[model samples]
Target: MAVEELVGPAPKGWKYKTLGEACKDGGGDIQTGPFGSQLHASDYVPVGVPSIMPQNIGDNRIIEDGIARITPEDARRLSRYLVRRGDIVYSRRGNVERRALVGHHEDGWLCGTGCIRVRLGENGADPRYASYYLGHPVVREWIVRHAHGATMPNLNTSILAACPFLEPPLAEQRAIAHILGTLDDKIELNRKQNETLEAMARALFKAWFVDFEPVRAKMEGRWRRGENLPGLPAHLYDLFPDRLVESELGEIPEGWEVISVDTEFDITMGQSPPGSTYNDIGEGLPFYQGRADFEFRFPKRRVFCTAPTRLAKIGDTLVSVRAPVGDINMALEDCAIGRGVAAVRHKTGSRSYTYHFMSSISDVFARFDAEGTVFGSIGKKDFHSISHIKPPRDLVLTYEKLAANLDDEVEKNEQESRTLAALRDNLLPKLISGELRVKDAEAFLKERGL
Candidate 1:
């Protein structure tokens, strides 16, 4: 069959082939790694080679941040299971079977018990092309259909080996991989740029507020009355030379006082209405739970309810009180929060300031977190009792103004990220399934000037 027949109508004639036929030997075989029981926790070392796990499998990529390390001796024992650069890693058992095709940087990574690594053979089949196919919605659906177990879904080696795929000629495979990789590269670049911008803002916040560098300079009497600070504008000069004083919390800069968070803001907890009262079919409000509801930009899953209470307004801050303390997120839409979330409404200036202020003090909240046998939670009373240093009204207003501008920029970046993510998700399935031909994609890209 022609390439057009395989990927649908084409402008030029090209060869077509099934994935199983293109590969010298179908897909790569799966090999399960050793169980966790084989190695002692004490065997784990710091800063050694990374030990990969199912949790390390992120969307379309492998995440190495939370990876643990094993000693040289342990590595030798697991040498046979070591992952190569082009291997595809799959979480064999989990609520969501995450899959990531290993990249060049992951050459020496080792796998954990929960993950099954697949090593492709030297046939003309490209691992990157196969990874795109495996990550497709059709493949994921097949995996879910064949997965076993009632408590936790799992895929055995036999099931994984039999997963079907549609593959074009080697040349077409390379072309498709290159096209998709280019888009991914751009997405990654945007992510890193946004991260750098966030880091710059965080540094500025630390310098002005946490480190007290600006306050200290002013306190030392080095700043001239009419001159502006190095990074700050001349308008900020009038607010300098803060009055230092002692308070119940301790010594603080002048014009700053210790105040209970509750007194300065209204705190409300979310409630999960009775299950009988739930109606998935009815016209209902968007219900958000704890940290799970929070994503890089907005909430993920929204529960429906005909009757909703405790609505969080746009720009309000949602703080997790249980499971994960100190996690903060901003509300982008009017939604109802679940029990484990605490919604904060600022009594004074811009709510954006309160979000930044809470984010800055996350470490403080971590220190006061109470551990439970099953879960960890922060007591609201204890949280309120913790004294917070509140700057003078005028300074707070100035900080709020600066914070609002920064928040606006952040919101714009988030909106862009959302748009890009949606485009990628929509195109991924069509591209992988060959429902949309590669030439069509190229034409589409040219039309968009991409």
Candidate 2:
């Protein structure tokens, strides 16, 4: 297909060239260093210079969260390997070759061994253009073909230097980058907003349940022998009379009770069929793994099986029971989960309340997880031993009312984010291929008022 057919028309004075010809040198320079053993977790205090690793470089993006840091002494030990702003970093030793271009935001970051950092020549190649080109399908295929090693495929400095691109003029490069960056900015905003909302809900839960502020207020009224408080309903009064109860776990509020997880809910482990049983015909049902199934978007890639033993209905909570503890998500459709996950169905009450309660207790379960050097897992026995603070029927009803409203708002924001992500992914390939021009993209954005 012609480029004009996808986008409107190319700008005047634009010249097309191969990426190698556009650069003064054949390709950018790569720097290597000693592995990450020089630093330890104790050496990493709260705030210091970031230490970039292969895991830090996401597919076509940079992840600033869950990063490690080092002290001045550690920095001095690895001084030669520090990366500057606008350096492109790529993973050299992994089955999936992850890559990301550094931005001006990360000016003086220290890089790890698993990545090969690239510095452009004096001709001033656009870093954003290089980033987009590296992420293109053709370039990735080329890297895979040239990758060396049997157990773990890898790319070295030489392979990365030879990766090709369809180079456009500098102005067009900047325009393409700017358009893509704008979409990313929106996605980042949605993520931050959702985090804030989730924090607010958790804070409210802490205030009322953990700190017992509401119970304290009620007790103060009873101690002074005064009338009921203004905000509290009449039935809630005298609910927390001066009393302490002992249980299997420990002392709890007077009226509160303890119960096993199975008593209140029906839980079952998921099963993964053998490789021969797996099919991508899109005929039977959706299949899922642990955390991959819980991504913000609904599962687009699906596997199917005719077996009845591997099915879970919508609204059932899918909890990761293995390696990573308590990664929970509610199913959006009838699906089958791998062995790493378990499905929970609430007994009779509102599933919303159960979901929130499980989320609240997730941290406690994580603590009881069996520790190991390589992998840690939480077994069913440990999960069954978890103690829960079961509130009275009226309080649970109150929690349900408040939580449902907040959850509705969260779901609305999630849906909008999904739509924006789809649009962004659809436009990225076309724009980078020169099949879609900047003017057409701008017009499309204007029509949507974005």
Using TM-score as the measure, which candidate wins?
Answer: 1
Candidate 1 residue 260 C-alpha distance from true site, Å: 1.4
Task: Give the whole-model CA lDDT for all candidates, comma-separated.
Answer: 0.70, 0.67
Task: Please report, as a residue range, the 10-residue window in candidate 2 with the lowest summed lDDT.
Answer: 1-10
> lDDT for model 1, on a 0 to 1 scale?
0.70
Best by lDDT: 1
Model 1, TM vs. native: 0.84
| Model 2 C-alpha lDDT per residue in residues 1-450, reported as the tens digit of each score | 112111223445454343334444535466654465766556776688887777788755667887877777778888877877777777778744567777777767887767777776556567776676566665676778888888887877666655554656778878887877777677767767766766666665665556555566655553333455554455555544444467775766677878887776777777887666668787667777676556542333456765636666766777777767777776767888778777776565555566656777877757645563566666666666677766666766675677667656666677777788778777777777777888999789778877
- Model 2 TM-score, all chains together: 0.81
Q: Show model 2 residue runs off by greater than 4 Å.
A: 1-28, 37-47, 101-105, 120-123, 217-244, 296-308, 348-352, 367-374
**lDDT tens string, model 1, 124-190?**
4778877776766656776788898898888666666656556666677777777777677776776
Question: Cα deviation of 272 in candidate 1 (Å)?
Answer: 1.6
